[model samples]
Target: MAGHSKWANIQHRKGRQDAKRGKIFTKLIKEITVAAKMGGGDASTNPRLRLAIEKAKGQSLPKDNIDNAIKRGTGQLEGVVYEEVRYEGYGIGGAAVMVDCLTDNKTRTVADVRHAFNKNGGNMGAEGSVAFQFKHCGQMIFAPGTDEARLMDAAIEAGAEDVVTNDDGSIEVITPPNDLATVLEGLEAAGFKAEFAEVVQKPLNESVIGGDDAMKMQKLLDALESLDDVQEVYTSAVIDE
Candidate 1:
């Protein structure tokens, strides 16, 4: 349950993602559109679309934007097609990094990611290189006001594995990969509101970094995440700074 402790590491990444609200809107819009196109627009009926809409709501994205995005996905409006891409690499301190992207151009996306890594003191690794350092899991962030004991009790019942507080005062709930959606549904049924919920890669062991290496690592991660094609960036560099 505790091979890594990159709490501060991820909070910083999330802040940067939020900073580009327009891009965030674009990403979420694409996700909602794709989900609705594939599974129909009813949030109650399509889990993927529901999650996409919920994520947009958490970001306070306009309802019109959300609707338009859904339309584009369903072909009522024009939209570019996107493909899912993954890149693994090493950041400062030799920590493993994983970036998930949604892009229309594979070649350009790869080149952009490589350039970002090189410019910021990192090297994108070959396929399956850094990826093996992590495992997939379902993760959710809960509001700060939840009763810890009650939450722990409920989560355990719903197959959750652990709950930890982030450096910025948020709470992260982890569950087995297969149990992620189930646990989240249970939590929601029980009246708990989560800010962000998704299945993601969790690093097994962290690279303890400090000083200049830490700064470099932060910069590299930030650069990778800022790319429009990049949807998520994960690393195992546990930095206290």
Candidate 2:
């Protein structure tokens, strides 16, 4: 796991996200609409919708915009129907990459994703090719120098699965995806707030990349993330930021 620093990665990604707020909104709106369409408009009864709405609000999406997106999803208003698709690939230095997308046109989305890979020192892989290198789990990350002892006690008591303190002194709390919101609330009530929290495809192993390869791999990832249809991108590459 050389060069693997979750806190650094999160900070870098958040900086990029702030520079692309408009694109972020589009992606969030799509998630909200699709979540509502698949589960229903009522967040209280629909876990997926509830998470989507939570994420939308976290981004400061306008209340009217959120409501309209829900209306579109429930068919009370017109909207494009989106289908979820995932693409797997290998980046520079054999780093495993996964791209999750919601698109109205599969052909166009796949073409765009493939182009991003091939043009940026990467190659597309078949389904499940790199998926096995990751785990589906909820992760809450505390910054370096946090009160590890107290955090661990609260996380375990809140039903978390594991707590690991990284070499950089940052703490990571792992939990079942379904328990993410509950565990987060519990920790917050105990006066512990995470710097980053999400249900992610946690990498089981790291692909350390540096120098030129790291730069190329980042280019590939950024290209994929810039696509309108791309919702999320995960990678096993670990590079010092």
RMSD of each: 3.0, 1.6
Worst 10 residues of 2 by lDDT: 1-10
Those runs of model 2 whose alpha carbons end farther than 4 Å from true positions after fitting are 1-3
* Candidate No. with top TM-score: 2
Deviating ranges (above 4 Å) for candidate 1 = 1-11, 37-40, 142-146, 159-171, 176-182, 188-196
User: Largest lDDT belongs to which candidate?
Assistant: 2
On the 0 to 100 scale, the lDDT of residue 107 in model 1 is 98
lDDT at residue 165 of model 1 (Cα atoms):
66
Taking the tens digit of each residue's C-alpha lDDT, what string does model 2 give over 113-194?
9999999999999999999999999888898889989999999999999999887778999998878878888999999988
Residue-pair clash count for candidate 2: 0
Tell me the lDDT of model 1 at 166. 53
lDDT of 1 by residue, 1-241 (tens): 2423344555665787778888888788777877888888777777678778878888899999999888887788888887778998989867999999888899999999999999999999999998888878888876555676777778888889988765445577898765666788888887787766877897876677888898888888778878888888888887657
